[model samples]
Target: MGPTRVRDLSVAAVAVAALGYAVVTLMYRHFPPITALSGMSLAVVALAEAGWGFYVRAQIKDGHIGIGGGRLHPLVVARSVVVAKASAWVGAGVLGWWVGVLIYLLPRRSTLRVAAEDTPGAVVAACCALALVVAALWLQHCCKSPEEPPDDAEPAAE
Candidate 1:
């Protein structure tokens, strides 16, 4: 497949955010308190992806061989690209959700103690989701093969 489009991601995020905002507006009172750690899992995943991106980039730059002298399989890179694309979409959706929640909560924070309490969690979650998107995109970039030179270029004279 081709590279993930930022335009598509943005549209998805906007749609999800709208939906999330509607849901939150309707059912926020029934939901439990949001904790700061609620989004930590996303952050953890982002970190893992970032590390993997670095490793894969190094391998690709070194001619598709690992630092340990093992060849990097094509399937492995394909799988990584899939994972990166999936994670990027997920992250965008989640980031939208948190943004929606924050939009709703921020306005009411002064009047509602619950909103004030949950604001921090939503902010943290949004940041974590953003990090995930960036890391996933980086991973996808790292997995790309180097560009080939134009076939029409003249050969160097001996």
Candidate 2:
């Protein structure tokens, strides 16, 4: 499979953002308040992926980890790539969702106590989502084989 492209991620984000906005707008009166903990799961995933990426990169670069009985498994790398791509897409979607919520709440904050209180949580969630995107992208990059050409580059002469 190919690497995740920014265009695809952007499209996903936009679509999710629009949906989030519509849902929140339609159900604002009955919607539960967004709490800072809403993004805790995402935060944990982001941290784990980022840390794993660094570890994999270091091991692969050493040349000792991927050899003998201690060989770095190819399946692990492939799975990491898949996870990174999925995480990036999911993160983008969440970020867009929070942005939608913020857009809906900002103007109403002054007159709506709930809006004012929820704004902080939404903002934090948005930031964490953004961080997840970055972390996932970094993990994807780290997972690449050193000898492989970049997705956008022309093939080298044989």
Return the lDDT, model 2, position 64: 37
Q: Taking the tens digit of each residue's C-alpha lDDT, what string does model 2 give over 1-158? A: 88788788888888888898999999998988789988778888899999989988986787635545877788888899999999999999998998888889999999999999999999889889988988899999998877855577768779
Model 2: lDDT of residue 46: 90
Largest TM-score belongs to which candidate? 1
Q: After superposition, how far is residue 41 of candidate 1 from its true place, in Å?
A: 0.3
- Which ten residues in a row are the worst by lDDT in model 1? 62-71
Off by over 4 Å in 1: 65-69, 150-158
Task: Quote each prediction's TM-score.
Answer: 0.92, 0.87
Q: Rate the local accuracy (lDDT) of all candidates.
A: 0.92, 0.87
Per-residue lDDT for 20-102 in model 1, tens only? 99999999999889989989999999999999999989988879654345878878888999999999999999999998999
lDDT of 2 at 11: 85
Worst 10 residues of 2 by lDDT: 59-68
